[model samples]
Structure formats: structure tokens, C-alpha cells
Target: MGKFNRQLVNEIKKEKEQESAQLKLREKYEVPEDVMIVEKDNMIKFSVRIIATLIKITIGIIIFLLTVVGIVSLVFPETRNELIFQLSNTLMQLKKFLNI
Candidate 1:
């Protein structure tokens, strides 16, 4: 065959190869035209879980502190009055510092 004929044949073969590759890719990863795929919103789910966990931890800490205070007040009734007086004085000092 002539040089021009050989070049044309090669070009046609290359185009056909490219077309077949495209078809294979389309077949492998085909999405239906009418169907819609909704992806899972993992970020929202993760945020909700994190917030819930933090709330649970905070509640647990508050409960623990309250239990400790109750035990201490029960064990040391006399000291409780002193503790309250000190806390009130500390709060006053803090208020003065903040000028609030």
C-alpha cells in the first residue's frame, strides 16, 4: 500500500481503539439516566455523633461533681458552712475583678 494509505489505516485503527476504550469505560461505570444516587451525608452524621458524645460527657462530669459535693457535705456538715462562706467570698472577689 502507498504511504498515505498506510497512514489513513493507522489513524482509523487508532480512532476505533479509542472508541472501544470509551465504550468499555462507559459500560464499566454506567449510571442510569433516570435513577438518582443520593450519597450519605457523613459530615452531618459525624457532627451529630460528636455533639451527642460531648453532651453526654458534660452531663456525666456535672453528675460526678454533684455527687462529690453531696458526699462531702454529708460527711462534713460543719465544714459545709465554711466552704459556702469561702465560695461566696471568692465569688465576690471575682466580681470585683471583673467589675461586673
Candidate 2:
């Protein structure tokens, strides 16, 4: 597996070198400054997509947890009562701290 990984890395490096050489050869045909802008745009777009996906996943997890809590509250009366008591106590503490 290590040998295969090394071979893959070497192949990728060689490909990148060849691509760079070609880009250099074609530098006169296009603006070099625009290349950087285009790369930055692609990076920003990719980053936004990743962030959106992460946000969606986080929301899904939160919803799943809420559903679990809801089911637990429905199934266990004692646990639901305990949780409500603890939540009220926490809220009261917060309210007192805020002098509200």
C-alpha cells in the first residue's frame, strides 16, 4: 500500500510539472494575472460549498438530537420531569444573574 501511494504521488507530481510547463508555454495567449483570479474564484466557490455542506450536516445532527430528546421525554416520564426541573433551575439562575 505504501509503495502504491508513493507511485501515485510521483505520478501526480509529474502531471503537475507537465501542466505547469504547458501553462508557461501558453502564457502569451492568456493573461497571467487572470489565472490567479480564476484560481482564487474556484477556491472561494469550493470553500463556500464545503461550508454549506457542513452547516447542513450540523443542522441535521441538531434535528436528530432534538428528535431523540422528544422521544425520550415521551417514553420516560421521570426523566422528562427531571430534565424540566433542571432546565427551569438553569433558566432561573440566568434570569437572576441578568437581574430580570
Candidate 3:
């Protein structure tokens, strides 16, 4: 039994040594290279797209605010009445110009 255990330990040690050698060979074959230019271009494009998206969102927000302001102004009684009066006057002028 002691001899059998010794043999088993020796076999395990041999297998471990073989695995370590293979790992060293693999590490020797693999080399690292620079990817800085690719990374920089990708970062710049990503930043540009982010800025463009932000600009579009800002424009959309501004247009939305203007629309809300226009609606609110039209909702007031005095402004509504004035707008209607102007529209009627314009329509009347158009009718006169067309001789209708």
C-alpha cells in the first residue's frame, strides 16, 4: 500500500510538471500589441455621437417649450380674443382682395 501511494504521488507530480511546461509554452507564444489608435478613434466617434444626440435633445426641448408657451398664450381670454380678431380681419381682407 505504501508503494502504491508513492507511485500515485510521483504520477501526479509528473502530470503537474507537464501541465506547467505547456502553460509556459503557451505564454511564450502569445504576445501583446498596441491598440491605442483604434481605441482613440472609437472614443472620439462615441463622443461625437453623444454630443450630436445631446444637441438634438436640446433642440427638441426648446421646440417643445416654445410650443407649450404658444399654447399657454393662446389659452388666455385676452390673447385668444385678439388672435381671433386678427384672423377675422385677415380673412375679411382676403375676401375683399378676391372680390368674394
True-structure RMSD for candidate 2: 10.9
TM-score of each: 0.40, 0.51, 0.38
Best by lDDT: 2
Q: Taking the tens digit of each residue's C-alpha lDDT, what string does model 1 give over 1-100? A: 5457888899999989866666665666685444433435698898998999999999999999999987897689797887888889999999999999
Against the unseen true structure, what C-alpha lDDT does each candidate score? 0.81, 0.82, 0.78
What would the C-alpha RMSD of candidate 3 be, to one decimal place?
Answer: 17.9
Runs in model 2 deviating more than 4 A are 1-41
Summarize candidate 3's per-residue lDDT along 17-90 as a digit string, tens digits. Answer: 86666666556665333211111358888999999999999999999998996797699988878878988999
Q: Candidate 2 residues 1-100, lDDT tens each?
A: 3456888899999989877765775684575543532233588889999999999999999999999998998689998898899989999999999999
Reference-based lDDT, residue 23, model 3: 63
Ranking by TM-score: 2, 1, 3
Which is the winner by lDDT between candidate 1 and candidate 2? 2
